[model samples]
Every structure is written in structure tokens, then in C-alpha cells.
Target: MQLSCPLPKFDFDVITLGHGSGGLLTHRLLQKGVFDILGNEFLGQQHDGASFHMDGKLAFSTDSFVVHPIFFPGGSIGDLAINGTVNDLAMCGAQPQYLSLSFILEEGLKTDEFSQILADIKTAADKAGVKIVTGDTKVVEKGKGDKLFINTSGIGTVHPGAAIHHQHIRPGDRVIISGNIATHGMAIMSVREGLEFETSIISDTVALNHTVYTLVNRFGKGIKFLRDPTRGGVASVLNEVAELTELGVDLVQSRVPVEEQVEAACEMLGLDPLYVANEGIFLAIVSEDIAAPFLQALKEDELGVNAAEIGVVSVNHPRKVIMESRIGGSRVVSYLTGEQLPRIC
Candidate 1:
């Protein structure tokens, strides 16, 4: 339910040390800023922690967001915190149910900016069908901290029969990417580095839980494995899983989806799109017999329109990843050896 208390106006335009002092100012800041916008039954109780129920096998995950330039093309750190955790649970074959938020704010930061972040957090949680049950807030000395940072913890229930993990991946399982790669990394780089492209390449930041639900519910165990290529990009994920399962993966460089602008940007920056990051896209390794129908269902969703079969698991080069070029040659695609873009979600 919505909060009934009238929001108290802050006397100061920006936050101060008093706001983090655990005094009347602290209560007022949460009441008028955070709780005022995100009030719900569990949060309205105002206890030290929140209580909720769970059934079936449960999945839990937590992550922190320190994305520089808090605001990006398609989303901000606020929504990123919520969606990132939610996607983590989805990749584990679970249905996200609840989330807890914690904020670290810098002294002298604008109160209005924090309020906007809270508003975006609410929008993202609602869209993902999850609740913000509890949270904490703290303030740091001005120069010691960035404008803002967030930490989110999530819990979800695993669907029955949806047994998915990297261990299940084996020879013959087909690899499919939900959409274009490297969009998010490039999107952040363009704005941060002041490189302009003909088209505005926004970050592909979105929730993937719903689409994951559709696949898990329909395919069940046939969906052997699922993963959202985040910080390490698709290449990193493939390399790690290959080493884990001790099976080689052969990817077609041409089959991997890369946007025209993103490819060009990568070329100019002397970067490989395979090593970039993505927030909204995912990879699925499914049984070959089920890959066709699964791809059809995935493409039905807006995010998977450009989805394609990129590769397959092989036993020849165990514990390695090989990429077949569009020119009919093969080469090794190594793990991400270093960071390409820092503070990119």
C-alpha cells in the first residue's frame, strides 16, 4: 500500500553529514525520500529486517552497482541494481520474488537526485514483479565517495523440472544468443569518452526474468543451461564454462550478433566485441532436438528478434574455445585477460 504520511520537505537542498548521523535527520531523510516513494507492507513495518515466505527450491544472489556517470543512455545505476540481480536469479532457473536495497551516498549530493533514483528503483522492481522489502542507507565524506552507489540482494524460487547449470552442458548442445552483444559496454564507452556515432546506441539494459520463465516453463530440463553475459561478455562466459565442463566450444564469428554501429565502434577502439559486456542479452545451451522450437519461442519476444545459433559444444579441443571466422579459418578465443572498460555496471 502507498504511504499515507505527508512527505516532509528537507530544509537543505543537498544532503549533509547529519543525514547519516542516525538521528531525527536520518528518519526524515528515509521518510521523505526513500520510504515515501517505495513504501509497501513489508517495508512499512519499519523493522530491522523483512520477513517473507518461500516454497520449492530457492535461489539467492546479491550485487553492488558503481557504474560511473550514474545516468546512462537506457538506464541508471538504480534500475541496473534491480535488473542485474533479477537476471542473475533468472539465469539460475528461478522466479524472482523479493529484493533489498542499500545506498551509499556522497556528502553534498542533491536530495532530488537520490529521489529520482529511488523512483527509478520502484519502477524497475514493479516491472520485474519483485518487492523491496528492506533497505539501509549511509553517507560518506564528499571526496571519498562517488555521487551514489547501490547494493541489491534478491531471492527467487526455482521452477520444478527446470534443472539448469553449467555442469549439464555437454557435447552437441547448441548455443544461442538472445540478442546483440557488446551494446551495453559500447553504450557506456561512447558517452563517457565523448565518441559520437551516426545512431544513438543505447545500453541494452532490461529485465530478462519473464522471457526466462517462458523458456523454463516450456522446455524444462531440455534447457540444459542458461547464462546472461554480463561483465565478461559472451566470450568470457564461454571460456569459463568450457574450462568448467572440460569441453570445447566452437563459435562462428559471423553467427554472433553484433550491431553495425557496435562493430564499427569496436573496430575503431581496437576492441573485440566478444570481450565486451551486455546487460540484457543471454545465452542458452539446449538439446539439439529442442533448439529449434526454443529459438522460435525466444524470437517471439522483443528482445530475441535477432537471436541466432552461434555455436555448439565439441569434444575435440577439450577445455578450450575456438572461433571460426567468416572467412573459413579458426582461431582461439581467449578469456578476458584484463578490464576493457572500468565502472561499467
Candidate 2:
């Protein structure tokens, strides 16, 4: 029964089942596809997990990425898992150290896709200078699970002089965004349905630990609150901060950055950019006196090139978010009542 079937030519761009076989195909995929784009010092070693050193108090955080479609324009779930956890620790002003990854794979999933995701995770961790020290994997029956889901836990050490928390926020503090908003959410939306536009938009997913580290080292206690708006976007994060600190937030429409492509997509879809997810962005509350210097430092970093003072903490209307419209009218930016887009990560 030795019937031979010829291998098909690899003309397709999409993933195939054989890629995850842990064999030659998997190795080649990692070498020519994933690693070639994201090669870094920490990832070049190609160990199960990365190892590094630290010097300060320890901080830990974990997050899971279940963004539908897994693959997006500028990043994938693998990097998302790593960056999300590292950013969580970074929000607390910590230097990310180690990571733990767990994967849930659906039955009949493509091995190539899974291998690519794993390679992405490694590349992301390496770029952030963190290690994936431990991990787990599981299989679920088809239809019961999405193609794949990834959970990542991270630990880092807090710098000696760094101290940031919601409670530290006070009226008159300035709010600065690391960069443009809604790029990640819109990028996902564009790819999910093959929506085309005049210009291309890419996801903003990335690790913010190093940028945060630089800010903390220079600004120290002046940096009051740090938050990465993920699921509910900047509006949700701001509302949370207002509730936590019992302060009101007022953001100017003109100051908040939004890409034209994202704006057009949101308008066409009747979606608001404020409620979209962002990966490579953050919100920083700092003393008004140090705002200029902080903004200067942030602009130096690639991720913070578009950093801007979008709003300020206010004492009036505690626990509320008010936005001054571009037309000079005031409106309340409330929390999302229902999920606008699901599985957006």
C-alpha cells in the first residue's frame, strides 16, 4: 500500500496544518518567516525561555490574548500576549524580567500557524528584554475553542525611586498619551472582513516597559498614574482612573491623536475611536511642572513620537469623563454599555 502523493506547490500565503508538526517545516517557517522579521539578541539564543537579571523590588502581572483572527496587520496574538503582560508590569513602573506562557489550541488547528505564533511570542519577549521562563499547552475539541488562545504571565522588578498609582493622581495633573489611539482595533477590523482603504493601518501592539522605565528613571514620583488602555480603550481607562481617584477627567478633542485611516474606518462603521483597543500606547499622569520634560523624553522614543498632553485631572464632576468637542461643545464620554466589537483583545 505504498501509494505516493505529490506535495503541492506552496503558492498560498495563508497558514497550513503541517507548519506546527515540530519538524522541518516548523523549523523553516521560524527561520525564514517569523524570526527573520523580529530577530533580536534575546531571541537569537533560541532557548525555551529567555533569562535575564534584575535589580529592585519585584512586580508581577499576567494577561491573555484571544483576539479573533490571531494574525493582524502589524502584529499577532503571540506578541500581543507577551507585550500585554509586560505592559501591565510597566504600568506599575517595573522592569519586566520573566514570563509564563500557556496555549490552548483547538483540534484540527494548523501546526504552521501555531508555530508562527510561538515564534512571535519569543521574538516579542526578546525585544522587551524579558524571558519566557515557563509555559503550558492544551488541546480542545474543534468548535469548542477558537483556533488558538494564549495566556502570558510576567514578573519584573520596580525601580527604587519609582512610585505610581491611581491614588497619586490629583486635580491639575496633566494627562499625556504615549501615541495615537485606535490603530490596533481598526487594523483588526480592516483585516477581519478584508476592508480596503486608501491608506494602510497597522496594529500598535508593543512592549512599553522600556519607555516607562525611561520615564520613571527621570521623572520618579512626579509620574502619578500609568495605564495601558486595552479592552475598553482610552475612555474606559480614564473612567476607571476617575472612579479610583474620585476625580474628573477633561480631554480636548483636538489634542487626542487619531490616524486618518482609523478615523475614516470608525466613521464608516459608526464606531467611536475612544472605545477601541490599543496595544503600543499608554496614558501617563504627571505634575504640570514636569510635563514638558516628560513629553520631551517620551518623544525621543519611537513609540512616543506622537505623545501629546490630551487632557487634565479636574476636581469637578468626580468620576466622570467630559470631552470638549472639536466644535467647542462639551459632551460626556460614558463607559461602553455593550460590547461594540468582541474578541478585540
RMSD of each: 3.0, 6.7
| Tens digit of per-residue lDDT, candidate 1, span 1-345 | 122233334556898888888888888888776777788999889899999777779999999999987888787888789999999999999999999999888999887667667777888888899999998889999998999999999999999979898888879999999999999988888878566555578889889999999899999999988888989899999998899999999999999999999999999989999989899999999999999999999999988998999999999899899999999999999999879889999
Worst 10 residues of 1 by lDDT: 1-10
Residue 214 displacement (Å), model 1: 0.7
The best candidate in terms of TM-score = 1
Query: Model 1, clash count?
Result: 0
The candidate 2 region of ten consecutive residues with least summed lDDT is 1-10
lDDT of each: 0.88, 0.83
Candidate 2 deviant stretches above 4 angstroms: 1-56, 194-199
TM-score of each: 0.95, 0.85
Model 1 TM-score on a 0 to 1 scale? 0.95
lDDT of 2 by residue, 1-345 (tens): 011222222323544444556676556645665455444565567677776776658898878789987987888888789999999999989998878777777767665566567667766777899866655556667787888888988888898888798878889999999999999999888877555454488899999999899899999999998989988999999999888999999999999999988999999989999999999999999999999999999999998999999999999999999999999999999897799778888
RMSD of 1: 3.0
